[model samples]
Target: MALTFEFETEKVIQPWRTITSLDTTLLKNWAKQRLDDAHHYNMQSNMKERLKEDVLKQYVKSSEILISVANRHCESTVSGMFKSVLFILTSAEGIVLSVSGPQELVNTLNRNHNLGPGSVFTIQNAGLNAISISIELMDWVYLTGAEHDFKLFKEWDCFCSPVRQNGEIIGYLDMSFSVQEDHLLLAGLFAFTLKSIEEELGKQDQQKSIYEHFQTYRLSPREKEIGYFWLKNYGALRIASELGLTEGTVRNVVKKIYRKTEVSDKGQFIRKFLNGLI
Candidate 1:
């Protein structure tokens, strides 16, 4: 059976409502309260030293898949008119993992605002910008101009949403650009990009589940290798060609896998795997 991925468009698209139907009065009051809280904590707008190279490498490696998906989306979908916009990915704790967009725009933001990999954007570090506030609320947020507590972000509009995997927030994706007439369309695109990221994460979880479940079967290394392809619906001839084995050997391995997995046939194996009965 082919892998199946499903996501509710309505649920994924719901966060854009925060942008289109924004309540200025309430947002202003909230921004004021956040600013007051930042003042109480004596937060500074100055850029702090970024994470050490080794530490930053680990965070980037952990978010490799997320960064890859975001980069592809930016290149394919967010180019042209949105080229100046910066897509920032940060760890759940708010350390920037990667920044992608127009090369000139990325460089400008890095030089002027310290918006680059390893830079921290937690509430304590970056005050009340969209990334920090989204982390605080664990939800999507849109902040523009005066809504930001820092002078650096006063000329930009930011839309941010948390990226989750296995029902837990793993990181955040933020799109920031200078104020523009197409702000609403930009926000919609940001939401769609986030939905794509989460969908890929969901598929990763399913693949991981398949690997872990296979581990419990006590199959040998070779058996496990062949069994994986079988579970993915690979026929004996294709599995043999892919694995560089004779078709007879591949068929023999499949029979052994069926016996070990207690499944009478390929269909039974797939059904059991999908239902978590394996």
Candidate 2:
């Protein structure tokens, strides 16, 4: 689980006055050195299919809450606050986990940026995205149209901030909009939203330890079978089918599980079970 990495020596000081004077020349150069035209075309052409088998699938169990909260925030923002904003969530490594916005705005990003889950934004692949920049810079960053090195995103602006848990960066949240939108306001909003996410993640961490202790408790064979699927986030019907039992039987077992685990509802049961509370 311990992967090693090294970042190039780039200036920590940020430039505010002129786009041309920004300290991103090294990022543009790195992008050019890491990929070529064919790589770019391949990524854009097959991104949708690649999303089905992303490396982040293992992290999905814990990330579900993060993605849910972010999507809800995205829906609320786009419904009235910002008409053209598209929110993107990415893992610490820059691999996108989810994207949300109005259908028209989403479609435009898909068409132009191949925006989708499993897509990676990095200096090595795509040049100068808010998510990648924020992670690299370890701070909030707003990239305006002409500030980007990639021609594909020359007319777009982005506000990005990193999401942290236990003082370590875990992911990134990005809000992209057209050049006419208010970048400064959006960046401040992103910072506030990130703080909320960080607080939620902290609670989840506390709950996870409680659930892990529950895993040591003993269970009957049938209960163990069902619990196995439950831990994987499988639904009752799906669990029944895979275990060759009826849905009613699955539900009955779940009821017994709830009683034994001292949980009242599916949400409590699932959170505890997945976290190891049961």
Candidate 3:
């Protein structure tokens, strides 16, 4: 719906009709910033190329969890009825880590838009995309219709949110659909996905902490493996069979692990491992 008109004779501006009033203001500000930067929408044409190894090495470490979590969720959900949606994960600096969708959508995005894994989005290249703008604003952003700088993307609806850790933006999670049928629906989905990614990251952190606590006991790699299996309630025979060791050898290792860890029984060992005290 057109909120107002600059001139009654002029056709309604597409963004005025599509985006909320607040978002329109934000869009205008972003446009002004682009102009101020002397950045054209398509100026960074080479961004679609593979990210340099050195660049990735420098940037992807902190975002690895976000990338992994987003990729896992997208792979499981971005098919069947959701096949038209493209889910993208990009680093804080807008380096694309992965793009997931049906092959048809993937091909279309790649061929027409130069969007694929390893693509970069920056003030120089991406002109007001969900990913690019979210990077700029560090907030949730939705871009569709004429708000997109490129005509090729105007028909697609994009929803993106900043992925954060330690209260700082680490990357972005973006989903693009060919049509603008459901902004609110996609927004809810994006929020839920972000929550799930954060939860998964918490689990990863806890697991790492637990592993580090376990390492403080100076267990060898093999003993650590055996201890993990032991904590899982595997019998000595099963552990030996799985690890290709004789049962006697496995039993000896288990004894050493118990002594070194100071656990008198399986229950105590399990408790200590779970509490990260061993």
Candidate closest to the true structure, highest TM-score:
1
Model 2 pairs in collision: 211-275, 211-276, 211-277, 212-275, 212-276, 214-278
Worst 10 residues of 3 by lDDT: 12-21
lDDT of 1 by residue, 65-110 (tens): 8778767775655565534777888999999988888888778767
List candidate 1 stretches off by more than 4 Å.
1-46, 79-83, 220-229, 232-253
The CA lDDT at 108 in model 3 is: 75
TM-score of each: 0.74, 0.60, 0.69
lDDT of 3: 0.72
* Candidate 2 displacement at residue 235 in angstroms: 31
lDDT of predicted model 1: 0.77
TM-score of model 3 vs. true structure: 0.69
Write candidate 2's Cα lDDT for 1-278 as tens digits: 99999999977553222334446775555456445653453334223223456465865655787777767766766677635777888878777888888887677767765777777787656655666677777777778877665565666798777777778887888878889887666766666666677877776775556444545665576787786677667899999999899999998988887788888887786776554332
Off by over 4 Å in 2: 1-33, 37-62, 111-113, 210-278
Instruction: Give the Cα lDDT of each candidate.
Output: 0.77, 0.70, 0.72
Clashing pairs for model 3 are none
